[model samples]
Target: MMNDIAKMQELWQEMSSWMTTYMKSFYSPEAAKTAKSHLEIKSAKTIFFDDAQIVDGIILKEKHTWKVVKNCENLAKHLNLNEHDSLLAKMIGLFHDVGRFYQFTVYRTFNDALSENHAKLGLKVIKDLPFMAKLDEEDLATLKFAIGNHNAKEIAPTENQRHLAFAKLIRDADKIDIYRVLKPFLGPTDGTGCSPDFVDLFVAGKQCDYTKMRTQDDRKLVRLMWVYDVYFAWSLKQIVEQNYIEDIINNLVQDEKMMQGITRLRNYIQEKLQTKDIWQG
Candidate 1:
């Protein structure tokens, strides 16, 4: 496992190098500066995760970030975004979870309710980065807005279409990778069923409050309900293709109400899968 982890780290390092070179050649001088700053921050992050005292925690967090970065790039390609938009997508992905490291290191837990909102914490970290100043005012705000709202149950409203688009893109990318991160942890429930409020939300086809999760089953149900919040057909396609939805449903409690929600979700997924994913921006 350690060897596999090392290899994954090496692969990310290589990809970072390649991305830096590609951006330098393909982007304008100002954009190249932004890319360079991104590389510098990424390098620092790699070192911090590598040298952290908690080896296991750092590895998982680091791997998740890399996976989200890849998902962002793939989603951008799926949308056929222009080069500038593509770069922005990837940058937002890279920094979206920047607060997770601090949250884990000090609090020793990733639960925002118990600790801090990692998304907001990440915005503070990004705002202080000297290199971030290299980005123009508009790009910088878009980056901040996307990262800030990435973990929110719903994105905060915005009038700028470009800002909204990037926010949606990062949220989808983050959730897609999150399903993968949480997959291995799926298991038999602790015998305590989901909370009543959670069940009501599920039955209503709505998202449950993460802070209200009271049981393992509730957590599983919350993951299932995330399908309702997914923004893009392309993201839903990836989630279904990987069997995340099926796997979560299989592990969920099979009570009548749960099944009703499951039936509703399956029908929704089927309909969503058939729709074309057209990027509006």
Candidate 2:
């Protein structure tokens, strides 16, 4: 018992340091900057405490879980990964946001700014759990690398080719499912307008020009711009085939600049998918 506790502490300290370094380098500065005021935004605790209340939190959890399952199935088929790799990918996808559960339970907010990076918190959860002990050393390392860095802007520079490949796979799979989650919230909801700070992190390049995204509606357009960060041709093909781009574009406030950006991104992916050998090119 003493040995187990000590080992857990050691692992926590090591992972904590690694997460700090990785976030310092790769965490989205724009997200933190734009949403400074919302850093303390809290989730509705009443929803969690009330027995009779219909909570979006429970619905969101179930929906997110379903999305992860779909991502695992589709990615396994698309990538044609080996059995071990396929399992690793699926497990990583399933557990990637486990931290969010704890974060909301404790802090009552999904906002990482008010709490800690859910990725790091997830690592801690995995480490503390008994199930994680069953994984082989290499599989464990890959999962850690993938879950810890899936939300990062890009893979860490220190990561090797193998780690990078797994990271990219999980990242792509996560983004693909997120489209489903964003569908209900894309446009105006009720009387309360959206907040641009909500998506400032996802805003990147000219497609979501930070300066022009002064309103929540404009920032919502950044969801369509996720294609720019897609790392796999197969993932791009899946997005195109599913018409995720069109769905996002249709819901957004169609402006000339936003449409142009989406069109250019659509063209780029279409051309990439058309290539006979995408991996080589």
Candidate 3:
């Protein structure tokens, strides 16, 4: 894992240098400077701090960010959003996890209860740093709202529908890719210090009732609940096509109860996908 992370960092540096040169060719010198400064801060503050904890957590997170960005692009086009909206969606995905770097660096765990609310921490980074200051007022608010609320259980009531919509996009995109991250890591392994009990709970026969989730293994239930948070049918379609749920289930110990629970969740998603009134309304 350390070797993989080192390679990823090296690739990131190469990509950053290439991008800096590319930006200078067409971007105004001032814009180029700001962009380069942003990259420098990302490297110095988040990516290259020489901490094992930060580096380890960020590899999955950084890949997740890129996946979300691509997912948002496809979602925007399918939803027929304007070019500006599409770009905004991509940007929100890119910047959503800025807080996680700080959280992991300080607390060494992704658990918000143990550390801090990563979303709020991310909001502070965006507002306090010049990294996101280049955005105009409208773009800035949308980015802030989307990133700030991406992890919330429900979208906050908003007078601005755009904020809710963009937030929904990021939430769906983020959750969709998370299945990829969880598949390999959540299971039990020998001598790796992974929790076998957690893997059992994950592969257990019933949909984990969140209220009943007291053990660390039960926490995997939250990933299952993400299906409820999904907004767009397009995102749901992608989830289905990727067979994310099936892949997850395949790794688990299945029984009648587990099958039933999985069926209920899958059916709910299918119902949501077919319910045009709910989406249009």
Candidate 4:
């Protein structure tokens, strides 16, 4: 257990070093200009949090736990990992959002569509970096797949032991965190209407069908349906256990037509849990 954590930390520190430098370049004045209209560059005050140490602690803990579970550690307790699995998960999670530093430095926001794909830029940084020189062939191969296609469409990995699952783990973990972060901040109590962008995404079906989800019931339904898109049932339970669905419902402004059925929403989740397979429920 300790060895896995230690190796993860080593890879994380190395990746962080590379990222800190890459961010320095990626968030420069020239870079901000390129990111215009997507993410506005905010003042340095917004670029960093009040405590650098806190950021490090949180990122390290979450990213490492995420990598382990995603690479299949949590799923199969006795599964022995070669150096490749550990290396791949460790390196990819560490670098996945280094582009975020640039987003803050340049765009002032983390919304992907409104901005750009941080994952894409992250890959560019890794490819351009010198760290590739230190990797073994297998190590590099795993890292390349994890880094390059971590955010792609959900598909089974064609390779041994399902390498792509490792990549999807980070994506699922990241989305769960997003739900946790944005749920409380949505600013509506009824869940009917949300920010215009949020509304439009649903209305257009460009996102899930939640535009008219005003009642707590509707909100719960939306969240239930969210399980369909979730990468794994483990991730689905993560949101449910965190009570993020309820938070989103309580935070949203209710659309009048959607208000009456709120209590039914919680019941629905309970109902589904009782009848559905736990792995899929």
Candidate 4 achieves a global lDDT of 0.51
Across residues 1-281, which tens digit of lDDT does each residue of candidate 1 receive? 46544543454455455434322332233333444234432332232223234445544666677788888989999899866667667778877887876687768789999999999888876676555665568878998999999989888988888888899999999899899889987777778889999998898899978888888888899999999999999999999999998988888888898899999999999999888887865
Once fitted onto the true fold, the runs of candidate 4 whose alpha carbons sit more than 4 angstroms away are 1-13, 16-84, 148-161, 189-226, 252-281
By TM-score, the best candidate is 1
Q: For candidate 2, what is the lDDT?
A: 0.60
The lDDT leader among the candidates is 1
Q: lDDT for every model?
A: 0.77, 0.60, 0.63, 0.51
For the record, the alpha-carbon RMSD of candidate 3 to the native fold, in angstroms, is 10.5
TM-score of each: 0.82, 0.68, 0.70, 0.55
- The model with the greater TM-score, 2 or 3, is 3
* TM-score rank order: 1, 3, 2, 4
Pairs in clash, predicted candidate 1: none
TM-score between candidate 3 and the true structure: 0.70
Candidate 1 — which residues are off by over 4 angstroms? 1-53
Candidate 2 residues lying further than 4 Å off, grouped into runs, are 1-48, 51-55, 188-214, 275-281
lDDT of 2 by residue, 8-50 (tens): 4455444433332322221123332332122221332222233
